[model samples]
Target: MSGDHSTYAPRSGFTKWIDTRLPLPRLMHDSFVSYPVPRNLNYAYTFGGILSIMLGLQMLTGIVLAMHYVASTDQAFTSVEFIMRDVNYGWLLRYLHANGASFFFLAVYLHIARGLYYGSYKAPRELLWILGVVILFLMMGTAFMGYVLPWGQMSFWGATVITGFFSAFPAVGDWIQRLLIGGFAVGQPTLNRFYSLHYLLPFMIAGVVILHIWALHVTGQTNPTGVDIRKKTDTIPFTPYATIKDALGMSVFFLVFAYFVFYMPNYLGHADNYIEANSLKTPAEIVPEWYFLPFYAMLRAITFNLGPINSKLGGVLTMFASILVLFVVPWLDTSKVRSAVYRPVYKVCFWLFIVDCLLLGWCGSQPPQGAIVLTAQLGTLYYFGFFLIIMPLLGLVEKPRRLPNSITEAVLSRRQTSAGRPAGATAAPEDRG
Candidate 1:
């Protein structure tokens, strides 16, 4: 599970002494500095850096915006408006933070898709992938809490509907709901706690992300071939090499983000958010934000009530279990080959998973009746089947392509035969820095 290179921990006193001036410039001399990387990393790998940038942007804008806004459920919506109208730069900050969320999800989905496509979640970096999942779940919870702060109709009702789902458990579900809400309903207290957590959880995610990278450094990144790059020639120092590549990737990603911010800031947003919350008159349809739709749809798919258990509790467990199923993926997929490219059966099934996700997203936005319900149920079934049946089956049936003798051989082969580039094509020019 460990990478070939030992980590660069701080050395002893004399080493630390000379380190400050001469520095462990050797640190940069390692993988990233002049490190050669996969010349064909593709767009998916760009996401980790893109997500990091977006998290920073959201944090900065959010802190400034928070200064103008009140957290009280009563004053929350109005204070937001005050910031929009009265506070300088409030509109800019709000839009950036909100749109940053949409972009964050966009990048994360692509990142995850890339992992699926390239088999980035295989044995060597499985923990990094799991850490990414942890970050993703926290992002969701953070986004949910932030969404409620606007105190708009969708925000208020979304909280009510989502929190109310907890009561679907058997005997103790109702009590859990009460504990979550501090009462039978989602109201002022729920708003306060959610807001507090919303503000706090990003830091927690950052801490985990640090661990994620620590894990990444330990195992190194898995490429499309899932080959371990062990030879010294296979890696470049992480500084200039990874730094430049990451920068280029980030720049390309920001262009997409900029277009969203400048041309259509509200394109991804629901129009209902403009309306103030009305506790008495509910909106006919109460869909959550697009990012939450797939799982939201999953929660609504269970219609048959369990004996003495509410359908809502059924939905709640189904919701959590949907993600819980993912935690078992490493074990669930028993394929010897890591990359789906070499595993034809797994490749097709992985695409099926993508299709199911898209279908679930569509179902989430529509009424939970008739065709929508049927579609959700089917999609939900396939979602589980991909993990439970398809992945495990493919491991037994699929014959993998011959693997390269080493990671360097694999990278070299692709460079020469496929890309028409030299073996060390990704290496920097002399003045690259």
Candidate 2:
């Protein structure tokens, strides 16, 4: 697929000269305009395009926010207030940027879940998956840094708490923590550094996104049936077809985003953030943004010590390991079948895993006491076990149902069944081994 060159022809002498030099237009045409996509892809496939739009929106809004944003400890919170009240349309920009983060995460989570459901991370696309995980990590860092820019109560304490996580390391933990904050605590230096990094990481994410797309084009997209595209009938050009669908999906997404931005701008933010940072006082309950809650729950779930490892360090490691484990998922799930659609047993386990994650997120949001703590511990265990144990074991023991011969076959069979017509003969049996 990577070798599939653009068939674009220059229409003018100037265009021909540029095409010979850069071929930039040609690359765009090949990647998006004339790209061949599986005809059977569902709405889930549209999230990728939606996410791209969100990233662009974020970068554009963030740049404008930074123009008026004061990153100093003394003026940061007031600057945000100024943006809301004094600056022209600054309230709109700030709200859009803030809420855009949530929308971006929402789209990305769905995109990742879609990938997991269809085995988009399997062989020949492992690097594509890894690049995606890299983008995720970068996004988390950028968001965390951006959150600290407000320098409000939660912003200050959240920074203090999260940066202190580095102190969980055995010997050099303290040193690392000090380095991160640039002082003894979350102060002017910390705010300055976060501001600088917040500005930098998104562009880095964009760079990696380019690589992710390149890798995607190389391997081509995986379909619902988990079968490779073998014929022209299995795919369609991306222009008009896929592009139109993506445009519609993006329009619907922006409608929801606009509602939140206009009517419920502060809906996703903490009320405590309205108050300025107070080094002397801390909120009774410190919580992260909703998106980070699941991993945060995992971090707080470690209440007991194991051997030489203390609970603090263990929790930190567990929280990070949860994300790190995704890097090796392609190898961990031994099943040759990519999509869960044909893998009944795997489908059940997949939903259970999703539930476990939600439980952990809920646990993270609540106080870690009594039932919540126990549930979080259980959920965390299951989260790891799903990837480490169940995925591998299921691949070896469970039988996947028959897969369609091609993407076209899967689409037609579904259509035939929906129309109350008999589907064509099934393909030959696939090797279980």
Best by lDDT: 2
Cα-based TM-score, every candidate: 0.88, 0.96
Model 1 over residues 1-433: C-alpha lDDT tens digits?
1224535444687766766677554454443444445533545666788888888988899889878888887888899889878888787788888999998998889888888777777787778888888998899999998999998999989988887877766678789878876777778888888888999999999999888877776676767777667677665555555677778989987888888887898898888888888788798899999998999899999887878656777778888988887677777787888887688778888888999999999999999988999899999999989889887887888898887766677777766786644534665776344
* Top-TM-score structure, candidate number: 2
Residue lDDT tens for model 2, 65-122: 8999998999999999999999999999999999999999999898999888999999
Clashes of each: 15, 0
lDDT of 1: 0.80
> Worst lDDT window (10 residues) for model 1?
1-10
How does residue 401 of candidate 2 score in lDDT?
Answer: 96
The list of candidate 2 runs beyond 4 A from truth reads 1-5, 421-433
